[model samples]
Target: MSDYDSGDELLADINAESIVAGTKRDRSESAREVQLSKRPKVEDADFGSTGSNSNDEFVEHIAKTTLKENFGFDQFRHEQFSAIKSILRGENALVVFPTGAGKSLCYQIPAVAFEKIDAAKNGRPHLGSGITIVVSPLIALMKDQVDALLRRGIAAACIDSSKTYEQQQLTTAAIREGRLRLLYCAPERLNNEGFVESMKHVPGGIRLVAVDEAHCISEWGHSFRPDYLKVARFIQEIKAERVICLTATATPRVADDVARAFEIDKSNVFRTSPYRPNLRLLAESVSTKQDKFPKLFKFLREHPGSTLVYVTLQKQAEQLADDLKDEGFHVAAFHAGLKTELKAQIQDDFMASRIPIVVATIAFGMGIDKADIRNILHFDLSGTIEEYSQQIGRAGRDGKPGHCMFYICPEDFYLRENFARGDLPSRQSLRRLLEDLFHRDAVHTPEGDVIKLNQTTLGRTYDIRASPLAILLATLELRFGLIRAITPEYSSYQFEAMYNYYRVVKDDKSQEGKAIFSNAKKAQKWHHIDVNAAARSTGLLRADVIRKLNDYNDRGIILLKASGVENRYKILKELPSTPQEMDAITDKLYAEMETREEDALRRTQEVADLITGDACFALALAQHFGMGLPDGKTKCGHCTHCLTGARVVLPPRPAPSVDMVGIQKILDVCHVRDDPRFLARIAFGIKSPRVFELKLHTKKVLASLEDHDFSSLLREFTKACEAANFGAGTS
Candidate 1:
């Protein structure tokens, strides 16, 4: 008990024992419980709901019984049984079923069955049970599903930003003790080191990982989320036993991307056609944006059913909802920017049939489970075929007729195309990012060369949006293998004792904890510890100090908060050392960005073509997913093209022109973000976060040339910046 005379001596002894030179310490904790063996083959065991049990019969019996007992269903929907069978057999599966096809049940039933089957085999609960980790996209979806599961007496939980630290700790503790059967989280949680470290020590390891909305993993897919790209890597790191990738819509090419990422076999891929016979596709051409209101009103009055009116922007949703409400229509606006409580209330109102029409952006309908939505109206062009399919699939879940109408106009096309073109970062910004990576930013550490990136600051400085910057960083880690991201850490920690401060120091038995607590500087009611200063003073690793403090917080000895988070990356290989080498690397990256930009434009055009083309509407839409008409029929007789027998032409947009006065007004705002790309974004009306923060979007000068080509505006801005000596030597 008495190894040293003083706390300083104790700390020095501990530091010497923990610190290693020129090598990265493994941060993963050792498993406390033994790993369980794989499930016994069903043929070798007598495990079934009834007395008789064959391999297939036993699995089917358990699945059906679990479904009946847990989810209250007597029969399996199309392809659900097959997908669940693959999962029960411990094989990776890719499910490309349409929306409302019970995809959630495919994984949820299996999750519960794992424990039930184990209990059946041993005549008791397994000693070290594994849990299923579900990667979902939305926090609201997570909460909804978790609540539903809990109501069914299933132990399920979610980890998301909305939860308090105390709640997260409770969930984490439940996961470690095998008290939970299913855990839901977003794909970004895989990058969280604290969560990853906790998963490393889970009782029997993660048994199954279900990736919901799995098409987001594919950049080729319409709804490509960059965070989804890291899912396969996360799965490998966790070494989960089985995985099921589920999506409501995926093209053949997108399916391949998902399969390749998860190592799913060709035979394991299951597809139920996304085509719904009950839903009719309709299209109309509008002369102007103002014309959509009367047409929408007329349709809604005729239908008088729950409807979702899709819009392109959040403000448009608000404006439309206001206009409709002023016209004495019961409606609400739903978008991502709304407060959490308000969104929940809106969701409740919509589900309860209090609001019949919701004018919303793309964020409204991911996890809502209402069944009788009768109409889905697109007030603007859908961003892509995949998006249109997924959105419209939300209708007619109860096997009733659902009408889907698309209103197309020339201005909609221009607006969407302008956004697509503005998404790319300029070539100069890419070069600047490379320079910072290889030069002023790199910091040498024991593990490797570390670069601390302030993502917001860097985004503004280079005129790169966060998603694109995330993609660029991910490219460095995944595509090139030149770097790997480490856990981001705060520069400082602020904590206060739950009770007496001295009592905390006395309770912490570890010397590292003692040093950390003793060194915290008291400022008013709270105590602050500069993590870097404490590391140097105590001769402890930064990770070690952070761990102990988090441990203290977990034990309820202190309330903790941390700030100044730095996104750290460790260089895995030598970066380009020469100017020529740097140029070559940057050029390749910029070219890829351009390729992505072109692909976005192509997708936008595909939507335009879908509305105006002479082909049968339903057949062309089905062909996008690589399918044909039902029963070898040449035409879906209900679609607009088949019924009308004529193409609907959209009105043409005006020629591109920019006012010189408006251009100068935009340039005046460029002093805040002096980069030429930033100037061009203002001129073309692209809302980067910094631009939004500056409230530039509210100005009329912004988007002055929104009808003009983005590349042309970029060239114009570059010339203007050089002529005015604006942002000189900044690049």
Candidate 2:
């Protein structure tokens, strides 16, 4: 044993110990990851595939295997593995990732993972899912995903209004038969009676509900969908064990809103870093409209290979496409205003490389998964950083370098602000809606205070669009609990007579049935028998009548279809008794509308700042999404601002001044909404539910302050209140 040999031997032993210690540390880290990933199920059920286990390794193993076998991916990317594992463990997961970060794989892979596991154990794909139901807003997006899923040899389907009833029926059957690993439906599907019934019959069960574009559920989200509000209720109805919410673009507030709405554990809410290194951000200053057109043409000529030219309006898109076409580019226009077939064709052509450039509005790229987009050019401001993120995200998705450029001009604010303001109804519209729908008994009711609305008629009246009116009505329902239950089935029936309904009334064998039929047929059509009316006349219990109707329909005694069904609204809560009470409720809602508009405006201002600020455009935009720039990486060298060392110093915002007498007159005109903030909104001509009802927007009586900027008015009023040191907070 020489000294040199002993030293070498000791060093070898030390290195071996270090290796073992490191492996143990790695194992401990993996265990910690599993422990923190626990998202408890909303209820207990046989997950069938994700057996009861505490091993994170099992979930991770399944995720990797599913990814490779089903999605044909060698490994999970970013948060996909964690999200999928959380879902399979019956834990609620809310995941916010940037677009093209493979958010879809989080749910889609899990859908197949569950099915494969269950099938492997049972030796067959049986009737089961407690299945994965993906609630998406766009039919085209659903179709695209389903098409992709089918291509990957996964069982996936979607039920939407775009399909014929028969086609929807077939799709629904597939869902119920437990053959589908994933099913996509619009949020409106929750309101659909037939679809709801079919979902209830899912043999595998609706164990997991994945809400795509989860940001839509938040009123404060950049894009709010009224239908998204009903999703939580639908999930409750199905008693789903787990929920996984995926959104490509969500701010901190929007992410919090989604997690709270879905009852997902706050700790379980995972967000991928918003920073995308592959994208090169650029901002082009357009001092005039003229500068933008020539610059846009030059950029289009330079950047080729799947370019997206985003404009503010459909007309602008069409004009841009036309001009680009004349400039020798293969360009086509895409906007929601285009027919569905045309939009689909354009999307297809764009994906297949047929269309080199697409001139589109804000509606073009949501849920679109084309990978090779080389450039995205914003012809106008997108009104918000969220909008900008979502739009620019369409480019550089393929892990390839991509360019995103925005042409900024101060003059574009008018159109953008107008678009944001249009979403809010003037206070007058709200008052008229309240008067017609609630207070005045405008709903055609047979008896009692139950408000029965012919939806089409009420919706079309007073020049109110149906969608906006529905949102208002929904707001009333949610805020005040005014609308109790809304059933689209106006009629319920029980019939099983082989002979004519009139003759069936005399059958001794079917005496009670005959009596039921006799009473049901009186004044009411056989197919549209009002359950209450029939049960009352026949002296049978309402519950029994409903049961028999179900039996009869099942037995094919009489072919029952949902052809003439109309919506029936039950009023559980009484209307505001007096005009004063109604006014108060209207005023509160008006404040909400103002907040929504302000949200839009604030987001637009952020985008403006992003373009004009001297800071790295990527860093400014990334931090807007709550992700900090890495240390020592203060400047993103890829941005146009950083590259060119260009900066724009914006002029100081104008100071707001308020006229006390003008404010007092406005308060006198609107006694219900006395909050200084609410008053300020009105002073700036922001729409209000009650003030508009009072016709306060007219030329006289406090309407003269409309010329003031909304933000300034709000700031001045807030300051005035502080100066006076009274009426500080409404609450």
Best by TM-score: 1
**Cα shift from native, residue 443, model 2 (Å):** 8.2
Pull out the clashing pairs in model 1. none
**Residue 269 lDDT (model 2):** 83
Q: Could you tell me which 10 consecutive residues in candidate 2 have the lowest summed lDDT?
A: 2-11
lDDT of 1 at 226: 74
- The root-mean-square deviation over C-alpha atoms between each candidate and the true structure, in angstroms, is 7.3, 15.5
Give the per-residue Cα lDDT of candidate 2 at 382.
Answer: 83
lDDT of 2 by residue, 144-169 (tens): 88999999888787765344334544
At residue 511, candidate 2 shows an lDDT of: 34
Residues 51-135 of candidate 1 have per-residue lDDT tens digits of 4336667778889999999999999988899999888877899998887788999999999998766666773243345789999
